[model samples]
Target chain A: MLEKNKNLLDIKKLKVSFFTEEGEIRAVNNVNFSIPNGKIMAVVGESGCGKSVTAYSILRLIQKPGKIMDGEIIFHPADDKPLDILKLGEKSDELYKIRGGKISMIFQEPMTALSPVHTIGNQICEAILIHQDVTKIEARKNAADMLAKVGIPNAKNRLDHYPFEMSGGMRQRVVIAMAMVCHPQLLIADEPTTALDVTIQAQILKLMKDLQKDLNMSILLITHNLGVVAQVADEVAVMYLGRIVERSDVRTIMKNPRHPYTIGLLKSLPSLSMEKTELPSIKGSVPSLTDIPNGCPFHPRCPYYKPKVCDAGNPPDLNAVDDNHDVACFRTSQIQNEIAGKERCRL
Target chain B: MNENIKNITSTPLLQVKGLCKYFPVFSKGFFKKQIGVVKASDNINFNLVTGETLGLVGESGSGKTTTGRAILRAITPTAGEVILNYKNELIDLTKISHKKLKQLRPFMQMIFQDPFSSLNPRMTVQDIIAEPLVIHKMAKGSVLEDRVIQIMKKVGLKPEHKSRYPHAFSGGQRQRIGIARALIMNPALIVCDEAVSALDVSVQAQVINLLSDLQQEFGLTYIFIAHDLSVVKHICDRVAVMYAGKIVELAKTNEIFENPLHPYTKALLSAIPSPDPDKPMNMNISGEVADPGNLPPGCAFAPRCEFCVQQCEQQIPKLKHLADDRYVACHRSWNVEDSP
Candidate 1:
């Protein structure tokens, strides 16, 4: 059952570009998605696919040479009215008020995301005092409690520990505690578990899921692992060359994947059945941003690429394949047939 | 049990017995000396048969990488013996002289985890692949270029890419260049240390396939080390699970996945997110992996193991054969009849 909270974040046609010396590289191209209150939406894609850029664009964290060229990021904060996040400058006091106060982000690399010199407890308390009008003593106690809530053992004792003092898993938990101390309405986690081992990765993922239930905050999870998306995501968006090729419920995308890129990703994963001799991989690499193919960005590696349509012109936006399922492919039927054929033969 | 030992009678290409590597922590004092030792690998024993893949699966700082480096003689081992069977003659690699080791280096090669760092930045792909050949005096002149092109083709690279440097290629293609260099020696055993873990899922499959095909074609054995269980399952014939510095479990790939015996292996397998969205994951393991330097008294995993008992904390479990080819290092393996 879905939660009864209102839509906390609405993003429409978000186009982000980077002014590189080579040329203007389009990192996020006309991406559109929304996160309902307490829901987790996963954006899955390979490297250089703009999943991270989309998350950064929402928090207005895009650095120099990169700008949100067009689109709207309407965030209806829990305590305040709706506001466009893109219009707020980085140094503006309004943005500083909302950056870590209303919306928090957990980066991929814990070592770099955290300050090397500051204690983990101080970092968490800093977040708490920045947003909430809390005293230093209360913030320290609250930070310890938050750390304990994320399952960090001896949290009170380790309050003075630096980032290097803890293991990767513990450091990540500290990061999560800092992000959640503010009780933000929307949390953006970019590849949170990519650097951790499988066991630690599972623990962090479960912590995020459980915290979402208790805190009732929407999450925009950006990752490249389809396995992770299957576990924690309610909705899935497959990105290719900065465009959303498919967006649907986790079940629809996994069970009936329509886009060729998504299908290729699923096929590429090694299964436990141990029956197949060789894993089937997509043919080629992602085209460079400066040398993006004309029509479909995935045509070079797509196995079911049609000659005239996929090569001559761009494919349309996501068309509804089912009630909540949408795909942006002109040859979904043919790709589905190919996937079914492979499944039948394997069976 | 005796018959099982007898079944492994063939001369292994490489055999490591009681291998241990300890790094000494030196302080700047009047008599600067070894203060303490970081026991990276603790009495690890394994045998790699010719033309078979032996996967080494472990978490970070588990000594899996150290074990690979010790086998290649890249780092000096504090104690132990490494025997290599070259052309039906047993050669003790541990006691060999430095000059002789250099002569013997051509037959053994390693593929590093990151392709970007492994390749030379200033050299072309052709030069990188042919460096081993030139150093070993195997080929020169146009023959070296032809051989480099040939090996590149074998690894799914075009001949035209030989002149380009490693920076010009993608991660997958750069890994292919690393593979070409490793295979150029026609090494009997190749140690792949997290070789494909740095690649994309789709690109990982391609490199794995190329490795397997090369293995079949050249009768090459591999000590494939990785942290990903699924990738290890696909490429390895037998797998070893490591914790801290000890191998906790070793079994056939199918047996290890189907009937995992060790508690740590069970937790690891259960933690891997299955692609089936309808199936709810059994993600219930608690506590983080303990630091290697400050491990528990007996079993390194006893602190995090849910099935730990008093005996587990007092006595270190020895790796023992349980079934036909399965080996597990856990005192509670007999108590837990089946793994869920």
Candidate 2:
């Protein structure tokens, strides 16, 4: 059922854990998914759900005490046969060949990503020089060209501007320029616009969407905000406590969410439409990564909890209801029935 | 419109007029010379009746938080009249003494954004909640302990967890503790400064519900200062949009959302990323927020605004009332279209 042959990047049983002094923090459990070529896949969850950890693991960016225990990251290049990224050495040329050169990443804050002292032009050129075979003058020209492509005005003049000299939106554009200068196939954006105002966030999102189309690159967007997910994502992976509870197209996930956690997340958002008066909050908070609940991690706080069924059994396998939609829930059929009834009533 | 103006000013719970707070920036040398002033809260005006929520909406450096702090007397205002309707008397807080302000503090309280840093890590949850009461000399000894537990229970915090430090609790729980402390004093007015902004979606809902519940039970008024328009639209009865240390728009939540007058408000309303995936994301305001220290000769938002004309660049718009309780500060307020 797992179509590795047709996918761009297929991850199977990817487990990432951090060993704290107190105990082992199982940040990511056996996670599985595939990013289709040129598709925007969003893995969304609250803090400590291991969404960021999963993103970081793709490039082996896991810091000290954190280990990617076991997983087969089958990456299918445009010309070559599928190869497992997990098998590559830490400092291997193969790993270096893919990281930044093929799959680049952008962070939430642009200031931290770019050095304050370095000029914007120098920073972009430096990245281009390392990845591409180019002369000093050619790299500078390419950097200015990149700035213009990202919608920055007067690209040549902006080359000498420091990080602090530009606005937040401009700084983010520069960061995007730096990330996309190499023209990577897949861009992993982790809360890229979280720190920005909604206005600037719109511009940034627009930039990324435009760039994706122009470059034909897939995007893995990691965020806690469902609103952002709704805006840009083609497919959504709802993660809860280090596990994918649901994965489907953005429309299906928003319209017919079968997982209780996904339902609660949708319900939790205060509507701009002013449809709902009181937000039906999911009970209890996310458990500490070190002391996660047994069985389904979301069962304890889930509203439609079944005493022994949800709490006792191991997390259910991804049960397919539609063509591509999948939900990991023991009572998936029950939720489907309830949702159908609600829709009928509304109709 | 005149009728609304009369009712709003007749007996407001808290009335602020032309409130201004400017922080001096000094040019450093052996001798420090005053260079310029950071116009934090400039000529701000608003009024809130009892048991009503007034949301102060803005981005960073918009002076929403500064306005809240100045109202609470946390920071002294440069100039303005902050009149409070305490015990059927109009008391000017700006003119009150520090000693008098201390006594009147129990009537008003402010909850900060970051609960982790706001609550003392050294003190237990019980002590954190009890400190306000002890200082006011309202309850002491066993009575203080009982009151803290009572308030904690009201906010869904378990009495058993009272002895635990803030570090032991989660972000949501710490926020609950913060809420408990704010509600313990039974204050008439509470300024929730981005209260639920630091929380997760599911957890943010819990805190928002808790706040709504508390306001209902106690008939409390809140000056909800936040960057999230969705939250403000959900919880607030009325909202005030701030731009560069000034009140740009003020109206009922529905009015502001459905038919915003000011270009800034329209832009802000449109900027919100709707949770419904089908909703179009079109509003994209470029250009940085105008520096408060060295503002332009005209409207602060004129630079970024799409519909700004030559008049906007040369004239500073004054806050003026429009149709029935709606107020907007823009030279071309009538010309600006509403959010789609």
Candidate 3:
């Protein structure tokens, strides 16, 4: 996968599946990516693209019949040792240390993420106590310090407030506080600002950026919103169906999107610069997981689909378009040529 | 010929004046008594031009949806005057009876946010579209079926899929079904409350294009309620920005986005993460939305406002008219208009 010594978290040939009444649902297929230390790698896709599933598999958090069929998540700790996250037994000492201790995750819905009954302080303190060998008072002091650091007004007074007593933005900050109580090296924020208001979302995003800078932590930001990805992510991994279609540095992905799905998504967005007469929409809805097409899954809706190459068989493995950029499409070079020629894409 | 005649007319379609919807908050104790009122919508006013879209934009709990519901009488408003122009007569929609309102319902319809929950899971697509016609006694049997098919085709649904339920369809298709139901009655006024918020980007675009096309074909007036400012800017001719149960600002689509006067509006505009990475976030509004039950004595946004003054805390600002048909509610609105 990644040159082992350099990557903080390297995922190679990851596959996740969900067992249902009908059959097995292949959710994430052969996905590979690497997160460097102190950088944010955003995994973006529409609903059911398996971005969340891939994140869940990193911590062995897939619930019920859904399981990580095959994968290797190589996490390089600070001391130059690589730990296979997948091999760690569930609820084992090492697994527990890495799950919330070294790598903490924040969810989309802040209100439901935090327990309603417990005070915000108590919840944060619990996380601190679990990982640290500090007394309750010291943990409480650290928790309040984190609350203030996340920009909570009257941080000391807020220590006694329950989850219901706080606003959505406040709850999200509390969740962030909980995640950072132990100062984790990696933070997996799954649409952390989706539930808050746009204004409040601004505050939360800023808060996360500040925290990442201060703590020097790597982040796996999984979201469907491309705008959010562009704003915060250093690099991006675009997923469609169950596979990662493209991965690149954020700037290149935004300016020179090689994938058809990425192009459609960008064109569909309403820009603040000009009023669009019509937003160019990709034809048809996302195909049901059970009824996904063979070969390139997007061929049915792809404007540039070739009969023999795109639809005849499986569309081949991910190929490198540049040193830093990789695209899974069979026509990566052709698309790149077209984009270089300033050819208009069928959005 | 009919379209030409409609174009020649200058009359506004809907007029909302002093609209207010307050939910009573009871004190928690053995003896529960009304302690305060959650002013969901307070003294909101706007006029929708015929064959135009008026976008209602705000944060959650800002009463953007309440304004739409009040006009439709989906929720009975505490106080308001909602005048709807139908045929040659203007009727007070707020004062009408359930019987009279039923008759008027055909011309005014609403599409909800969630496509999944809004549509009945048990009903087939055919029956769902035909329900409106049946309730109004407009069509029956073959005619109803024909009408449903015609509307469905317009919204991009096939005749073969009519037998299937909403559950069988995708989110985008379900939204289309919702749109078809709203348009079946040939509504003059359609209130789309967060219609595309639940759909994916590509699907959202498709639905938006469909809505625009339908608007042009039917000469429909829309009150598009959404928190997304970009979508509002695209579809709406004018916009009313709500905050703390009050319409803090109203202006033309371009004017609202380009030259926002209200502090809250400015903050919201800046908050939208630009897809272009070069453009960084410029505004930071401290704290959350103020409690609607107990809004500040001054401007509700005063607590978080950067330019808030003593007047802001002592007295509430009025939605005062400004130049260029713009309206703003702020003590320091003059400063905004003059700023670079």
Candidate 4:
């Protein structure tokens, strides 16, 4: 059963499709996940794996030709009422109220995220004034405070600077400050640190984690870095071909991955603990959306693929391996054995 | 330690010393002319031994990519010598003729950072992989096609998929095509510039493994340039940490990770996000990297270094051997305790 403790965001069997010239591309295929109140859940995968599409589905920001074909995106309001974000009609007043006030999203590219013409201060204050009933002067001060809260040095001076005048790290902080200015209950950050250097990335991740604790708001961090998930996420959902292949607590997933794809991913990562020998790579690439194989989409790359069960038919529904851990692989038991065998050989 | 030192002395395939590449900065005014130079690489020194992977890790504008490009002669260097050991003869790459340079290019190939833009989108995968072979005049006619198919299979690509264009493949598959092109030459030294940084973690592992296996098969030396410390730690035999067009620290992979000496190197390692969420973030350094064009008089990192003393700002530090093979360019490396 889904947790009923006033979950912040609950997505149920959400299906998203893109009506391309070739055909309908199922970007998100029956994906289900939930963010408990005041927790971080990371949706992780490589490019074209539909992690970003799922985040866009939450804010109804999917572009033309892309539609949420099926399922519900339920958001529990701060006032304790559940609203289906997918049901909100276009350009409705209710949609506008939740767009920037209750649910906020930060995009990957900061240059595009912030308008080039407007100063950062004006942008943050605009978000404040759009939602809250406040004067321009008061909104400006609130925006500056939010900037200061995100660790932007000399926030007052930076308020008058445009996006081009600031560095990449500073521009990203301004975006984060703007997203959190309204005290949104749910924040979605999509590959927020992908464009930043490692040092700046560490700083931003620390800032986000600190803010999450202070604000007690739920965050859905979408990134391809498993190391990042291990650092910031309490729970993680490993996505492949727009579906959740594995979901578990961060520690469990890192220590003992069940799905073959997840296991291959862990082995492929070049860790400091690994020796200078050849790295273990998954043999094949992710199938393109146009040529997604029948049955299991990951069967080709699955190391534990049993032809009759894995290739010919869909794996059983996500089976509970433990409390709060679920995997969609039919050969979870065999895969675990193989992983353990590999570890023994490694030792 | 002596084994690695012996390894370095045994036979260096490529030896680079005091390599400097400066781009003149021009301004438009009453007497507008070349007033200064952007020191992309300043008196950089390193040697690539045979069958060794030297990882060059640095932030953007640190000159890691420039160092790799200059070694390959992709861009002409302003000064310094590149002594390449070709068949037991040390030939200066800077002094080579145009035709000779073309002949030598097959021995040293470069794998670019972005696979999407690096590969020719207009060409089919077969043509993309076979370009290097054709350019080097290594194969022709049906022989070239067979070689291309063989290289594709070696890199985990299906031979039947060779007719498809780059747009039909994913990021991982496109990278494979890039690898096939780089490997088709059977070069002695391959410079992988941010090769895996553009990939997903899962796909990055596969590429890293493929690179390692290929290195063993061909006995190739790699100048692996990337900003990711973890990946560098896993693959590199030795690492050279660069800061503002200079090698600040050079040591074995474990030595550099465990005992990073330069202030810049220390800051870089601390900034790497540890996988453990329970452990608090250890990075305390602040402010963005200083502009490379207008670096400080002494150490470029002194402006943001936490342990900056009066001496640090007044005089530049020189690279000194701290151990048998470890080198550091910091005044405080001797006395500073482990901060990470």
Which is the leading candidate under TM-score?
3
Docking class of 3: high
Per-residue lDDT over A1-347 for candidate 3, one digit per residue giving the tens place of the 0 to 100 score: 43446678999999999999968888998999999888999999999999999998888899989989998999997754688999998879999998789999999999889898899889999999899999999999999999999998889889999999888888899999999888888999998988889998888888898889988889999998888888999999999988999899999889888898888888998777867487788999999888778889988988788888887677558788898998888787786677666745544
Name the lDDT value of residue B317 in candidate 4.
88
lDDT of 2 by residue, A1-347 (tens): 33335567898999998998988888889899999999899999998899999999998999989999998888887666678989999999989978887888999898899998899999999889988999999999999999999999999999999999988889999999999999998899999999998878888898899899988889999999898899999999999889999999999998878899999999889887764267788999999887877777888898777889888757788778789998998888886687788899999
Residue B134, candidate 3: C-alpha displacement in angstroms = 1.6
lDDT of 2 at A210: 89
Which candidate, 2 or 4, has the higher lDDT?
Answer: 2
* RMSD after CA superposition, every candidate: 2.9, 2.8, 2.4, 2.8
How far is B53's C-alpha from truth in model 4 (Å)? Answer: 1.1
Query: Per-residue lDDT for A206 in model 4?
Result: 86
Give stretches of model 4 more than 4 Å off.
A1-5, A333-347, B1-10, B28-32, B136-138, B276-280, B338-340
Cα TM-score of candidate 4: 0.94
Candidate 2's C-alpha runs over 4 A off are A1-6, A341-347, B1-9, B337-340
lDDT values of the candidates? Answer: 0.88, 0.90, 0.89, 0.86
What DockQ number belongs to candidate 1?
0.75
TM-score of 3: 0.97
lDDT of 3 by residue, B1-340 (tens): 2254357446678889999999988989988898888999999888777887889999999998988999999999999899989986999988989999988999999999999999999999999988999988999989899999999999999988999999999999999999999999989999999999999988999999999989888888899999999998888888889999999999988989898889999999999999988888787688788889878899999999988889999999999998755899999998756766
Q: Candidate 3: where are CA atoms >4 Å away?
A: A1-4, A339-347, B1-9
Clashing pairs in 4: none
